[model samples]
Target: MSDPKLQEKIIDALKTVQDPDLHKDIVSLGFVKNLNMEGGNVKFDVELTTPACPVKEQLRTECETKVKAIDGVVQVEVNMTAVVRSTEHAQPILTGVKNIIAVASGKGGVGKSTVSTNLAIALSLTGARVGLMDADIYGPSIPQMMGIPISSPKVGSENKFFPHEKYGLKVVSAAFLTKQGQPLMLRGPMLGGIIQQFLQNVEWGELDYLIIDLPPGTGDVQLTLTQKAPISGAVVVTTPQEISLIDADKGVKMFQ
Candidate 1:
């Protein structure tokens, strides 16, 4: 016979489990799809908001532990599946920009943004029209690194802000929207939305290359850009350190 008491305990324990990115309890967030208990063997399904979730393993482990702590549960099994958010399927708003290239690094502090900014400038200076998109929503250092003051884009009658021009390269970033020295607290879905707006809504006005400075790690932003946009290719940057190389491999596989 099934143990209703044990199942109740399992559900109560799951209340403490939260999605790392959304910062909401998994049960309330509706991630727990279904729970089945057959002869002390428990199985459950977890639906994630993004396919590139970095904490999938962590979540699985947490679920297992919570269920196992129940009195009658002998073993636990979890099946995780990613369901793309509704907004992610919406049509892109920048069709003018071309040749999107994601510049990524296995780890931070590898000068990936430096390479991206200089490359955009160099491409523009060489007479090929260029645009640089600082997609690093968490730590947007492009505006400062490129010496552009943190300022908002001028809203036009059409409700689109013209991109800021620097070194002949059109630039856009979340830093431009935020007040100076303010924190950008954004979740994965929000970050993906911002990137989409930067690409589709911004009036880049014809370009040979649109270089995207992706945040370090293999996460939602990287996955969204490549899947949403017609990404031509990606460039992986890393130091001589072996640890960096391991992360670099993960980054490359994210594209493949």
Candidate 2:
């Protein structure tokens, strides 16, 4: 039997575990699940965003160390898994943005949006001129996720559109243009064209970094951006889950 105080201490220790990419505590993000105790031996799940994560071993060690440090804890077992990205999440489209960095994942609900948003905020907090593009045309959520209102951009010369501003960050997304609750009925070629226009025609002005939140999976939009623009690099986001890591590996390959 485990002491109640020991379990509380273990949980408290885990509160210090941070998802390095997302800049949020792992416990708050629901990454630490299923804490079981048996005679001072503890077993828990350390769910991650991607399985192919370079930090897997480090995180596992950190989790173990944190759990073991608690008084009365004898052993620690961390069962790792990856979280998937959800289709309902929207991808942001950036315009006139330079140094594009696509945040991608093999599966949905892996906290890709959370990573993108926090990264943009962190970059901006560092005084870099930043913009976020929601490239997930089918499901756009940058507006809501970032707490920005949905409004159409103003048209300028040559019928170019201007990006909306939020927290000193410029942003553009499908959610900003469509009517509330309307379906986006677009095919591959059409969707690609729209993303192209958002990149080429929008008045993003000058920006140091443009972070793109890509939709889950390998699709036309992702290919279009890679081929159409000069991307600096790609960041793969995944939970420590096997299935998510398997898919994230494919995403890394797609970029390579």
Candidate 3:
């Protein structure tokens, strides 16, 4: 026979464990799923919002430790899984993308693209589906950095572009669309149009996060993204130098 009172004790014990990010217990956040109890053997799954959560193992360990300490509990099994959540009721403009993170800089030479590249890769290492979009039209460097050949993305039906696949990431950049060493004498409106094309017409498929490497400084690409897309967050890259810090300040305020 199942002991309802014992199960209640297990739940209460779990309630003591709180999600550091959500500032609430997992039970209150509806993270505990598929809980099963058989005599003293207890098993359950903890579903997190993002696979890239920094404290994933910590939560799993806490769940196991707490449940095992309960009286009459012989074994405790906790499975960790993730389902990336969107920002509130905001429907993503990118069909299957759950979150869009923009990486920008106040000026050039601050390594914004490099930081963005590593950020996408780090997220992918955590088992999250990640994509990188190089929005730096004038000097697209992600292709060279990522070793992606300068070639246009493959087109699908309805004029949708299939982003280039490289290093477990779906990548897209203007370098693929233009000739090598070609000077793009594009105006502000044209720049905005290009960004919109990349955002709406790319077949990014299902992604937990899409990292956009914006051009150095606030420009057409930044304006288009901020005005059109629901950006979840922004990162400003800069150097320790005062000049770099000054530009980075502008980038931060632009996003804010």
Top candidate (TM-score) = 3
Q: Write the per-residue lDDT of candidate 3 for residues 1-256, one digit (tens) a residue.
A: 6789988998998999899988999999999999899989999999999888889999999999999999999999999999998764354578678889999999998899999999999999889999999999998999999998787678999999899998899999989888877767798899999999888999988988999999998888899999988889999999999999998999999988
Clashing pairs in 3: none
lDDT of 3 at 68: 96
Which residue pairs in candidate 1 collide?
93-200, 94-199, 94-200
lDDT of each: 0.82, 0.82, 0.91
Clashes of each: 3, 31, 0
Residue lDDT tens for model 2, 89-145: 123443334467789989988988889988887877755678899988888878888
Please state the error at residue 148 of candidate 1 in Å: 0.4
Tens-place lDDT digits, model 1, residues 124-221: 66456778899988899999988899998987767777889888888898899799999999877888888878876788887767889999998888
* TM-scores for every predicted model: 0.63, 0.62, 0.95
Name the weakest run of 10 consecutive residues (lDDT summed) in model 3. Answer: 86-95
Ten-residue stretch with the least lDDT total in model 1: 84-93
